[model samples]
Target: MKCLLVSDSHGSETELSEVIERHRGEVDAVFHCGDSELSNDSSILEGVHTVQGNVDKPGEFPEDTAETVKGVRVYVTHGHLYNIKMTHIPLSYRAEETQARMACFGHSHHPTAFEDQGILFVNPGSVMQPRTRPEQTYAIASFDESGGAEIRFYERESAEEVTDLYASFPAGTQ
Candidate 1:
């Protein structure tokens, strides 16, 4: 299965719509890690799995969520409550408790993807306000039956793959 991971749009309807349109049929699922600053009923979020960010209004979106895709458990959050800017330890602990094979989050607006103790952690950066990187970014992750996964980061507007940001993990590692 293929999943599109994005976050921190901070209210760019055009960009979010463009991304959904671009990957609509190509991916099995779409995850919005939060800070969208859009309403829960926004058309742009029609089929997206989303969480709430610090800036988002409470009671509309969940603080965190989990989904099972192609037999892999994926945890999604906004990172504020977990204090992700200082460390991923808290989030990692949550992932472990949930038995999630991967965790996706945003808040630092830094595009990053890495594995620790078999679980993959990804931050797709801010699609509307990127930081710590020149280009705004998001990630596409593909998982196979054997449990192997590959993540490829891409420049948001251009939809260009950042080859150097690519990562691959063996089966069952996460």
Candidate 2:
């Protein structure tokens, strides 16, 4: 299964809609890690698994969510609640508690993907206002039956892969 992960749009509805449209039908699922600054009923969020961010209105969205996609258990969150800017330990523990093989989140707007103790943690960065890199980014993750997984980053505006930001985990990692 393949899934799209994005976050921190910070109110750029146009960019968010474009990214979703660009990957429509190309992935099994779509996840937004928050700070979208859009209403819960926004059309752009239809069918998207989203979480509330620090800036989002309280009670509009859940703080975290978990779901199984094609046999892969994924946990989604905005990261602020888990103190991601300081360390991923808390977030990792939460994902473990959820029995999720992948933990998707965003907050720092720094695109990153890595595996920690058999769990994959990915941050797709900010599509509207990027921090570390100049290009607004998002991530596409693919999972196979044998536990093989790979994450690839893309430039949101161009829908082009960022070849250098790819990460692949061996079957046994999960």
Candidate 3:
């Protein structure tokens, strides 16, 4: 199954819409890791599963969410509550507790993709205000029932793959 992971768009509705449109038929699920700053009823978020970020209005969206897509358990959050800037330990623990195989989040505006234990943690970075990298980015993650997985980042503006930021995990039970 394939999923699109994006976060911290910070209210660039155009970019968010474009990114979602670009992968509309190519992915099975789409998740927005928060800070969208768009209204909950905005057409831009029509089909997106989003979480509430520190900057987003309280009760506008869920604090976190989980779902099983094509047999892959996914956990989505914005990360502020977990203090992600300091460590991923807290976030990882939450994902583990939920029995999720793929964990997606954003807050630091840094892109990262890696697998620890059996869960894959991905941060697609900030699509509007990037920090460590110049390019605003998002991610595409593919997983199979056999445990094989691959994560690739793409520049939000150009939709070009960020060749340097990619990860592939060996099949093992995810």
Candidate 4:
């Protein structure tokens, strides 16, 4: 399965639509990492999975979300409750409890993806308000019930993949 990962759009209807159109048939899922602040649009509800960010005025976004997509246990959160800007301790704890192979979160507006402690942590950066000496960025992930997962990060406008990573949990662990 392929998934488009986004975060911190802040409220860009056009960019959101661009994401949808860019990955239309390319991926099976589209995940908004956080900070969309689109409580009114709800178009996200159509073909995306999302979590509430610190700025989100919520209607139905869960603090933490878990979903099984194409046989992978995925975790979603805004990372504020996890104190992501400080560290991933809180998010790590939840991943252990959930046995989630992949955990996605956003708050720092930096695009990153990595593997540690048998879990994959991803932050798709601020697609709108990017920080930390980089252009606005987002990410995507592809998975199979095989050895590992492949993740890629891209500049929003050029769609240039600037970073890539591969993750594989130890044997007999998910």
Scored against the true structure, residue 84 in model 4 reaches a CA lDDT of: 91
The per-model lDDT (C-alpha) reads: 0.92, 0.94, 0.93, 0.79
Candidate 4 lDDT score at position 11: 82
Model 1 poorest ten-residue lDDT run: 165-174
Candidate that scores best on TM-score: 2
Model 1: per-residue lDDT, tens digit, 70-125? 78899999999999999999999999898999999999999888999888999988
Choose 1 or 3, whichever is better by lDDT.
3
TM-score of 2: 0.98
The root-mean-square deviation over C-alpha atoms between each candidate and the true structure, in angstroms, is 1.0, 0.8, 1.1, 2.4
Model 3 steric clash pairs: none
Q: 1-174 in candidate 3: lDDT tens per residue?
A: 999999998889899999999997999999999999988999988888999999998899999999999999999999999999999999999999999999999999999998887899999998889999999999999987787999999999888999999999979744
lDDT score, candidate 4: 0.79
lDDT of 3 at 34: 90
- TM-score to true structure, per model: 0.97, 0.98, 0.97, 0.89
Tens digits of per-residue lDDT, candidate 4, 1-174, equal 678888889888788768667876888788887788887457654668888888888655767778877877889888988889998888999987898888999889977777778788998888889888467888788876673687787888887777543333443453
Candidate achieving the largest lDDT? 2
C-alpha lDDT (0 to 100) for residue 77 of candidate 2: 96
How many clashing pairs does model 3 include? 0
Cα-lDDT of candidate 1: 0.92
Error of 3 at 103 (Å): 0.6
